[model samples]
Target: MSQLPKASLKLFPCTIGGEINYSIPEGVKMEILECRNFIVENERTARRFLKALDRNFPLEETQMSLLNKHSREQEIPLMLKALEQGNDVGILSESGCPAVGDPGALVVAMAHKKGYQVKPFTGPSSFLLALMASGLNGQQFAFHGYLPVQENEKIKSLKYLENESKAKNQTQLFMETPYRNIKFLAFILKTLNPSTFLCVASNLSCEDEYVRTMTVQDWRKTELPDIHKKPTVFLLQS
Candidate 1:
């Protein structure tokens, strides 16, 4: 059999989402895999995580190169190729676990549908973290991936979510592209009632992490740090 250049995939969470970034000590020689590729947004979370693991590239590349016209057209193909090549992979996220508002969802989803073993090693998930922190409720929380992009659709969805939150007392978790987090906050302010409690779990499990629980009215006055491009998770409790 011919020997192939070794490559591996690893999924580590953003700095705010897991302990993998902070656990690596000074000099620990462990090179079981030939190559490692990390997929994450361009920000502190991703950078710090890699730094802690002491990954140097050409040594490590990002999956962003697979994006085709803002769509991950090549994600599945590349992942399949890697898996087929006998490379043990790690599919990581900028925040939370991989496949949850992260780049590796398509690949993981496909892996499952195709009868592949999809074993997962997870860290903190902002959705569950927020639910655990919020006093409103936790027994029943619905993780709504993201708000609708269209204006009218967003409005309608917000109204429905608000009512559902009120009736069920279930936490509703949502997020936006970190840069547009403020825009999503503004939308919440404009759509939800003033008294509704909103929890903005930005940079979870990190030094500058903020788990602020306040109402829409308070959010209006509170000087929130420009969490733009940061790994942010937003939650609403009515």
Candidate 2:
């Protein structure tokens, strides 16, 4: 008799901020307890999250495969092999939801191509959270991920996103390196129209969480918060 295939890979979402502040669902916890094979962005963070969920859980014995921006393409075969052998696998990211604004997306794509089922659990997502509170056009929004590193190129991209927003009434969303958040904010205030609506959601879900939407002109007048080295999401509505 042939062995039946195991259930689909579980795409688990970790906390964007402090795990203590946002609890993982009990259903996901039970799922974790039943999964031994996992593909994670960072083994250390994944293990830490699992331990936090259940202190008595044995992490050392679990089989872990690291997947990150630098992950090798060859690693996909091994992970798929584990799944083909009737073993359910878990995909995790360092923070927030996996496969969304994360490198784990590559693995998830491969799973789909190979006819593996994927199950995603509900969790905190900074992008969606910021949009929900942005008071912008959430129905029509586009996330441009990280802005260009070069100032000139970045400015050009920003201008394009701004004009596109005006033309289509779309909400333009993007992010920057935490350390460069203040600088990026400064650039936005200087480049975009003063009346443009901007939302800066920083340190989401944390005690020091800040989510403010205001006109670029108003933002320039207010005292800017210290967002250096912090996770932030930016949104604009023209």
Candidate 3:
């Protein structure tokens, strides 16, 4: 195979939540096989995903540069250096699209700043999937990664998002730490207006995936699921 010229960085998105074999596509698998260098959130997670795509792929041969929360500060320098060497690289997040809610954004921005191309591949995204099934204003929506950990701040932010959704006729989307899902749901039910619409999407792309939209009033009557420790996305629109 002839050496390909210096090309755009590939942003490969893995499934948000599910079995990799069923969720990942052949094209994505090909992309994974093509790249020998990658900037991943976690080397172990990336290796496992690549193995799921192809059991025989040489995991030890691939060069992976970590870009998680702890290593983020040092990643750009290394990633840029690799790109400058005319090597095509892939950015892999633990779940969903790289840089969407992940730490890979900084590297992507640097790639753009250096005038290097950055290409995003097709894949699952919890927020987009949730918005599609949300029955809310997808045309105008926002994704606030995580809510405040404190009770008072969480309530205040919920009220603002609810009001913003109602007044501007836009969808307001957000997420919480898996363990905090139940508590977050409770806060949404308590803070938002009774008429406001709320959508809870959990374990997306998984066998037990759940995405439901309902009014705050109606949600009060419905029993909350055990979303603890499950990847979940929440949306609100009035």
Candidate 4:
């Protein structure tokens, strides 16, 4: 489902990905989708997977699925039912804020469809945090959500952004799946103009958080961090 900006509303999307690798509390049953590793009781592997995904590129979407059909549609009803039954169904993601930049468009779409009033609770966001700390012109930043996925087109897309970030001086922020964070960082180091500055914000809102900044050339000279190992966000400024 498409998410709007966060406010003080209890109704919101959760990046269950954020709670991945942790034990699922008893009596806190959820309709666990068969997307990640089966870890109904604990999801260590799923947690790490998503963490790495966050480290590289901002995920373009967070679609929940079941056999043949999607589950986010069902999720809205389930959450409503949960609230009725004195329980709250957490629309959790593998990591990070749900529906912020991840895949929760269908669920959010369904909630609004059924006339549910939504109020978002404040939580961590990769895009906003990166822009705030990048030391760039943040007043007019434009988050492109996620970069293009196709290989050739993705590079071209980034190149185009190079011009946009330079000409307009808007800080550009995005991410990929956690496992690809390192590779993506490598590409950013290799491609973006030398004078521009890049920031890699990793494991944001976590104990292991790391943010690295460097020019294109300096990035090439120094070894990059293993961002693929955890939640990471990439930011660029001219």
Best of the two (1, 3) by TM-score:
3
How many steric clashes between backbone atoms does each model show? Answer: 3, 0, 0, 32
Predict model 4's lDDT versus the native. 0.56
lDDT of each: 0.63, 0.87, 0.86, 0.56
What is candidate 3's TM-score against the reference?
0.94
How would you encode candidate 3's per-residue C-alpha lDDT over 92-192 as one tens digit per residue? 99998899998898888888888998898888888888899888888998889898888899889999998888788889989999997887889789888
Q: Report the C-alpha lDDT of model 4 over 1-238, residue by residue, as the tens digit.
A: 5554332112222233344333232222222321221211113433444344345322233322221123434544543443333332334443334555545545556556755544444444666666666676778777776687788888897888888888997778777877877888887777788888888888765556677778887888887787876767687877
Candidate 3 residue runs with Cα over 4 Å from true position: 1-4, 72-75
In the range 133-225, model 1's lDDT, one tens digit per residue, is 666577788888777888899889888878898999878887787788877777778888999888887776666766778898998887866
C-alpha TM-score for every candidate: 0.68, 0.96, 0.94, 0.63
lDDT of 2 by residue, 143-199 (tens): 989989998998899889989999999999999999999989999899998888999
**With candidate 1 superimposed using the best TM-score fit, by how many Å does residue 31's alpha carbon deviate from the native?**
9.2
Pick out the ten consecutive residues of candidate 3 with the lowest summed lDDT.
71-80
lDDT ranking from best to worst?
2, 3, 1, 4
TM-score for predicted model 1 compared with the true structure: 0.68
> Relative to the unseen true structure, what is the C-alpha lDDT of residue 161 in candidate 4, on a scale of 0 to 100?
82
RMSD of 4: 10.0
Off by over 4 Å in 2: 20-23
